[model samples]
Target: MPKVSRIIPILENLLFFWLGLALVLSLAGDSLNIPSLLQVLGRAHPLILHFPIVLLLMAVAMLWIKDEKIKEIGTWVLLLGANLTGLTVLAGLLLANEDYDGAMLFWHQWLGVASLGLSVLIYFYRDKSSSFLKISTGALAVAIVLTGHFGADLTHGENFLLTPIQSNEEEFVALDDAEVFQHMVKPILEAKCISCHKEGKVKGELRMDDLAGLQKGGKNGPFVVPGDLKESLLIQRIHLPEDSKEHMPPKNKAQLTDEELEILQLWVESGSSFEQKVTELESEEPLFQLASNKFSNQKSYTFDAASDSDISELNNFFRKVNPVFPGSPALEVAYYGTSAFDPTSLKDLKSIKEQVVKMNLNRMPLESVDLSFLRDFQNLEELQMNFTGVTPNQLSNLEGLENLRNLAISGNSLGAEAVSVLEKLTQVKKIFLWNSGLDESSKENLRKALTTAHIDFGFDGKGIIYALNPPKITFDKELFQDSMELVLSHPIRTAEIRYTLDGTEPDSISSPVYTAPIWLKKTAQIRAKAFAADWTGSLTVSDLLFKSGIQPESYRLAFEPNTKYKAKGAASLFDGIKGKTGHGSGNWLGFKDTSMELEIFIAENTSPNEISISLLLNEIAYIFPPENVEIWTGNQQGWQKLPNTDNAQSTKIEEVRFGMLTFPLPETDFDKVKIRLRPISKLPAWHPGAGAKGWVFVDEILLN
Candidate 1:
C-alpha cells in the first residue's frame, strides 16, 4: 500500500507533463522543427496505442462488477489507463507533424485528446458517486471509439471499414467506347497507389489523384513519357527490385500484380494517351486484347471446384495448379522446368480436368507426349503452347475443347495442314501464330476460312522497323590467367551479332560475325551489336576483359564495410562474381563516410604489372565514383606509395553502370599490395541528399 502511494504521485506528475507537451505541440503545429529521433518515435505511435485502449475498456467493464475486490482492481487499472492515454496522445501529436493533415486527422487528434481528458477524470473520481462515475466512464468509451474510427481513416484512407461491403465489380464499358486511360489505367492507380500519393498524404511529392498531377510529376521527373517505357519514372521505379529503396508502393504496402504491371507497360508503350479508345488500336496488339478481356462480358463456368487434396497433390516445382481467382471454381494450370517434364504429368491432371479453364505448356518438350490428354479438359478456355514441339497432328486433338476461346501456338513449325485442324475449333476466337512457320499466303488462306476469328501473325514489319535490342555479352571470368571464351547472343535468331576488340564501334559490313565464342588471350574491350536484314541495328554494348598476371593467395580489408552491404567480407572482392546495379544485391561491399583499404598478398616470386578495381556508379542512389585511388607496394620491411590518380567528379545523374579503373604498375616484385579508395566526403549541391556523405561500392579487384 505504501509503495502504491509513492508511485501514484510519480505517475500523476508524468501524465501532467505529457499532457502539457501535447498541448504545446498541437498549438505549434507545422511551425515547430521536429528532431529525427522524435520522428522515429512518432512512427511507433501505431504500435503503442493499443495498450491504453484495451486497458481503459477493461477498467470500464470491471467498474460494473458488484464485487468489492473487482472495484479495487478497477481503480488501479484506471490509473494505469489514464497515464497511458496521455502518453498515446502525446505520441500521436508528434506523429501528426509529418505533413499529415485533413479533416480525418483533425478529428482523430481532438477526439484522442478528449478521450485522454475523460480517462483522467474517471480515474480521479473513483471515490465519488456511482452515477457521476458511470457518466464519465461512458463518455470516455465513446470518445475512444470515435477516435479510433477516425484514426483508421487517416491511416488506411477514408471508408476503410466499409471496403468489404463495397462493390468491387468494375462497371462494364463497351469496348468501342472505353477510353484507354479512363477505364484501364486510372483504376489501377487508384487501387494501388492513391492512398499514399493522394491529397492527404503526398509521399515523394508525387500525386496520383488526378491527371494534371500525373502530368506535373514530383521531384524526380515526369511520371510518364509517351511511347517511351525506359524513360518513364513510373515504369523505372516499378521495374526496380522490390528490395530497392526506390521501388514503388514500398515494401509493406500493396504491390502491383504481374497483370497490372503489364497493363501499365502496354499503356506507356502505346503513347500513354488519356483519350485513346480501345477501338483505335489494332486488334492484334496486346493492349487491345487486354482491353477486350477486361471489358468484354466474361463467360460463366458451371463446373464444381476440385477437391483441396487433389489440387495440393498436383502442385510441385515443375507444375502448378491454382484457381483462376480467389474462391473461383475454375482452375489455371501451368507447367515449368523443361527438363523435369514427364508425359505422365499431363495424365495426372485428369482429376481436375472439369475445373481446369486455362493451361500453359510453353517451352515444354510436348512432341512425344500424348496430347490426347487435353481432350478431357472440356472447360479449358485458354491454352498456351508457345515455343513447344507441338506438331500439326497433335494440334488436331484440341478440336474437342469446345470452350477454348484463346489459343497460342507461336514458335512451332506448323505447315498448311494446321489450318484445316485449327478451322475445326470453331470456339477459338483468338489465334496466335507468330513464328509458327505459316507464310503470308497460308495466313491469308486461314483468315479467309475463319472469318469470325482474329489471327495475329505478330509484327509484320510492313511500315514499322524495330531497332534490335543489344546483344548480351558473357564470359566465364572477367580476370583470366590464361584465356577465356567470350560469347555473344541475341533474342532474334535471324539477327547477326557483330563484334570488335579494337575499342571501335561494330558495323555490319566490316566487323567479324560472332558465329563462335571468341577466345581472349590478352586484355581487351569487347563491343558488340545486333543487326538484321530488315530491322535497324541495335546500340553497341561493351565490357572489359583483363589478363591477370598472378593470382592472389588471399586478401583482407583494413576496415569492415557497412553492415547492410557487407557481402562476404574480404572474400567478396576475389569471388569473380560481379554485383548488379542495386546495393541490395549481396555481391557488393559498400562504404559510407569511410575509405576502402584493401591488402592483397601474392606468391613470393610473382610480379604484377597492372591493377584493376571494379566499382559501381548509381548517382541517383548517392553511390559515386571514388574521389582518389592510391596504390602501395610492400615487402617484408615497409610500404612504398606509387603515383596516385584522382577521378573526375560526377556532373549529372546517370543510370546504374559499372566502371573499371586500371592503373599501370612499375616493374617491381612485391609480396603485398595495398589499395586505398576515398569516397566523396560531401554530395554535390544538385543531388537530392546534398552535403550528405556519398557511398562507394566495390565488387571485385584484379591484379595483372
Candidate 2:
C-alpha cells in the first residue's frame, strides 16, 4: 500500500462533491426530509471517509505527473462516491428507526442523508440538461463540506481536526535502575529462593534464589520497586508477552502464583527492603539426603519463586546421582584412580535399586565381579573399559544391554575377530577402539556392518598414516615475508619439491626445494609441492602448499572510475562489488594469496554528497549476498555500512564489523586512514554452491 499522505486527499474530494449535490436537492425543497437525508450521509460516513482523505490526497500528488495510474483511480473514485452515497442514504433510513436526542448529532445525521439523496438527484439531472451530471455532482460536494464542519464540531469541539501531537518528557518517570534494585525491592526475595543463586549456578543471572543476588540482578535486571508497581522492572517482566525476552518467569520455570506476587507487591509498597535472616530458628522437619533422582539440585537453577519444600527435595536428590561427573563425560573411571573408586562404596552402590546407565572398569576390579551380576543392569546405556585386562569376549555377559548405546574399549588387547561378536548388538551407537590390537580391515568391516555406529580404533589399521594434499609448506608466517622457512622433510627422503609462483597452478617445477628459508619482497607466491616415486620415478604422489609474500610496510592505493562512493546525501558510503576470487569454505588459502591495501577518499562533485571507507583484513576472499562490510576507527563510538546501489560493486565487500548494521557512513574529510582488518564467511550450510563462490580483490576506493 502507498503511504497515507498519498491516499487521503482523493477520498476527501470525492466525499465533498457528493455532499454538495445532496444539499442542492434539499434546498430546491424536495419531499426528502433533512433528518432522513442527514441519516443517509451519516451512513456513508464510515465507508466514504477514508476515500477522500486517501484518494484526493493522491490526486494532488498526481499534479506532479509521476504516476500514470492516479487519473484512472480518480475516475473510479468519482463513480464510487455516487454509488456509495446513494447506499448511505438507504442505510440511514434503518438508523432513523433509533431515537436520537442531540440536535447537532440529529442535524449532522439528517443533513448528511438529505445531502446524499440530493447528490443522487444531481447525479441524474440538473437545471441545465446538457451539463446536468457535472453541476449536480459539484452541488452535492458543497453540501458535504457544510455537513463536515458540523460533524467536526460534534467530534472534537470544532478545532480537533487541526492540531499536532504533544510530546512532553516530564510526564514520564526518571528513576535510576540501581536505585530501583536496592531498598525499594529486595525484601520480597526470601530464603526459599537461593539454592541456584548462592554460588556457581546463577542461571538466568537472576539469583532470586536469594535476596542479595536479587538486588544484583542477573542477565535480566533489578526485580523490584518502591511505592509504584507500574514503574518497577519486576512488574514489567510479569506483564511481558509470555514468550518475550522481557517476560518474567521466563519460560520453562515456575511463575510466581497470584498469592506469591501479592506478597511481593506488598513488600515493595512497604518500602521494599531485604528480609532478615534468623539462624537460631529450627524446624520440626529435618532435611534428609534426597531419596529420588529427577529433581536433583546437582543441576542448578534460579527460580523466580519456588516453595522451600520444592528446593530441599531437589537438592538432596541430586547430591547422590552426581557420582563424579553426572552430566558431563565421566573423567575418573574407577580403575584410573583409587580415590575415584572405593570397593566398599561400589559394594553398596551395586545394591541400589536404581538402574545404572554407565559402568567404568578401566582400573576397577570388574574381572573379579560375577559376570552374571552385570546382567541385572538392564538400563545400562554406556559401558567403558578403557585400558583394562578384560578382553572383548569378557563383555559377552553384557550382550543383552537393551539400553546400551555406546561402548568404549580403547587401549586394550581386543582384536577385530573378537570385536565382531559385539557388532550383533545393533543398539550400540558408538565404539571407541583407539590404540587397540585390531586390524584396519576388520575395523572397516565392522563399521560397514554397523553403518550407523562409529568405530574409531579397534580393527582400524596398523602403521603410520598421514594425508596428502595438493601441497602445503610446514612453515610459519608465509605472508608479510616473515623469517620462518619451509622445511620439506618427510618420513622418508624419496620426495622432491616442485611448485609454482602464480596461485593458479599446483604442478611441480614451480620452485626449487632446499633446507633453507626463502625470502623475497614482491608480488609472488610459491607452492612447496612434494613429488615422490614408487621405487621408479615415472609418476609422483601429489602434495602441495602455497606461500605468498607481501610488504605490509610498503603498499599503494588506487581508485577506479564509475564506482559509487556514497548513497546520496546519506551518512553511509557505498562499495558495489561482486564476488572476488580466493579460497572459501573448506578451501583455505593463506593470507598471502588474498591481501590488499585499500584507500578511500571523498569525491569532489557528485549527485550524492559525502562518503568514506572502512574495511578489515581477512585471510579469505569469501563474499555472500545479504553480505555486510563494517569499518570503524579505534576511537569511534560505532561502525557503519556501505548501502547497496544499482551498481553491484556498491552492495558487497570482504570485511566484517559489528554493533549496528544499516548504519550511515563516516564523513569524507580525513587524510591518513589506519584501520585493523577483521573478516567472516558463510559456510556451505548457510549458502548454496557450498559458499565457495565470490570474488576478493582490493584496490583504492572509487566513486561514481
Candidate 3:
C-alpha cells in the first residue's frame, strides 16, 4: 500500500509535466491541425472533468478527519485528486482550442489550474501548516464550483441557471412603444452570436455586441444592411446549410429558433431601425405578432383522456371522430355527407360522450329536435349546423354546452328569440346567423343581448360592383389575303364591348363600338373590353390579324420552333388563311430572341413589283416587334442587298398588333429572295419585364 503511495507522487509529477506540454501545444491551435487520435481523446474532457471535481470535493472534506486510518486513506485520495486534476486540465485546454471561443475560456481554465495547484499544496503541507491546509481546501472548493459553472455556461448558455428563475412579473413594453432593433433584434444576436463575434473572440472579425460593432462588420463586409435582408451577412450566415463551416452559432453552439430567425429578417426588412415601433408598421406585418407575444399572458389547458375502444366505435363511414392532437382527450366529430346522415346513428357516438369537443353537421338534414342529443356532449366547444333544418325552438338545447365557443347555424329558421337563449352560455364567442330569417332589427337586438359574442347576419346587396368577364375575340380566319372579319363579344349578352385597331387599349366612350364584325384589310390590332350597367369594367382582350400577301412557291426556316408551341406545319405560313389571333393558335410561329431567317423561291420567275413582311406584336405576351428587317434578292449580281426598304415600327401602346411593312422592288427579275427579321434583344422600359429578351411571333411573310 505504501509502495502504491510512493508511485502516485511520481505519477502526479509526470501528469503535471504533460499538462504543461499540452498547454503549450494548444497555443499553436491556429496553425496546427490536431491528429485524429488526439482529437478523439481531447473530446473526453467534458466526461472526464467531473472526476476531479468529485475526487477533490471528497479530499477537501478529509482535511477535518481525526482518525489515523481515515487520514491515511485521505492522503492517498488527495494525491490521486492532484494527479487527475492535471490530466483533466490538459484535456480541457486541448478541447478549448479545437472549436471553443476564448472570451470566457481564460477564467474557467485559470480557476481549474488553481484548484490543481491547491490540491498538491494541501497534500504536502497538511501536518506542517494546519491553518494553511484549511484555507487552501476552502479556496479550492469555491474554485471548483465557479469552474464548473463557467463550463456549464459555455456548454449551455450564459447564466442558464438563472434563466428559469427569472421573474414573470416584470413589465414588458407594448408593441407601439418598443423599438424594433433595440427590443426585438439585439437580444437574439447577444444570445446566439456575441460569444463568437465579441471583442476578444472575434471568429470572423465581426462583433455583434453593439450597433457600431455590428455595422462595422468583419473582414467579409457589414453584418447587416439597412433594407436588404438577402444581402446582409447576418442573414446570409444564419440561412446557410447547418453542416456548412460558415453557418452562424456553429453546429455545436445554440442555434436560433424559427421565430428568432423571422424576427431578425423582419428587423432588417424594416430598414434595421433603432427607434421604429413594431405597431407603426402595417398590421399584416409579422413584427406585430412577435412584439405582441412579448407581452401576451396566454395559457394552455389540458383535457381528460378518451378510451381507445370508444374512439374506434364513434368513428364510422358517415362520421369522423379524432383527437385535436396526439394523446389529447379533446375529439372532433364531423359528418361525411348530407345523405349519409342518419338520426339513429347518433347513439353510436354515445361511447365517446364526454370526449367530443367539436361537431360539424353543416348541410345535413338535421331537424330542430334532433339537436336534443347534444345534451350528452358536455365538453363540446364548437357546433356547426349551417343550412340544417334547425328551428328557433331548438336553440334551448345548446344552453347546457357552456363550453361552446362558436355556433354556426346559418340558412335556418333561427331568430332573435333563439339568440336570446345563447347569451347565457357566457363562453360563446361568435354566433354566425347568416340568412337565418332574422330581420335587421332582430340582428341589432341580438347584438345588444350578447356584447361579447359577434352576431353575423350576412350583408345586403348594395354598393357592390360585380366584375365583368373579359371580352372574347370571335373571328373565322385572322390571316387573309385581302381582308378578314373580326368580331368581339361578351358572354353577359347585354354588355357593350368597345374596341380599337391601332394597338391601343379600348376606352368605354372614345373607342369604336363593336356592334358588328370589323373588317381588317391591312395587318392591324383588335383590342376590346366589356362594360355593363352597375358592374365594373371587364379585362381587355387583344388579337392580331396579319394580311397574307402573294403566297411563296417554297420556303425554308433557319430554326425549328419550340416543341410546346410548334402548332402547324411550315406551309401553314403561306396557306392564305390567317393564323388565329392568340399565340396558342397553331398558325402562329414563335421564336426566341434569335432572328427568323427565311429563304423563299418563286416557282414562276417573274418581276415582283412589291414585297411586304408581316409580323405580330404583343408585349404582354412577351412578344415584341423586330428590331430591324433585311431583305436580299438573287439577281445577275448574285444576292444583292435590296435598297430603300420600309421596316416594321414598334409602338409603346400596351396592346397587341399585327404589323406589316412594304418594300418596293426595282425593275429586276429574281428567282430567289431571302428575308431576315431580328427580334428585340430586350423589351422596352414600359413593359413589366423590361430587362428580359422579348419573343418574336410571326405567322406569315407576305410577298407580292
TM-score preference between candidates 1 and 2, better one: 1
lDDT of each: 0.83, 0.42, 0.72
Candidate 3 structure quality by residue, lDDT tens digits, 537-629: 987877766666666678887777655355564675676655444555566777774577878887666566667655666654566777777
Write one digit per residue (lDDT tens) for candidate 1, span 627-670: 77889998888888997676677887665677677787768667
Q: Rank the candidates by lDDT, best first.
A: 1, 3, 2
**Largest lDDT belongs to which candidate?**
1
C-alpha RMSD by candidate, in order:
11.6, 25.1, 17.3
What lDDT does model 3 reach?
0.72
lDDT of 2 by residue, 1-704 (tens): 57755555655465565466544443442345557666665456456554543432333233223344654464445445545654454444333333322445556666666565654454334334535544445555566766666556543332335544544232221121112223223322332233233332344566564456666766645656564554456654553323345445554555555434544544455445554111111222111111111113232212222233432332321123323234432211223453354444444334421335566666554544455556666656678877765666676877877867778877776776665676786887678877777776877777778886656663423463433333334544323222335444444455565654333344445445544554433223354555564322222222222122111222122322112111221111221221112111111111111222233432223221222222212212132222334333212333333344321222322222111111233454323223222222333443221343232322213121
Model 1 TM: 0.58
Q: Against the hidden true structure, what lDDT does model 1 obtain?
A: 0.83
Per-model TM-score, in order, reads 0.58, 0.32, 0.40
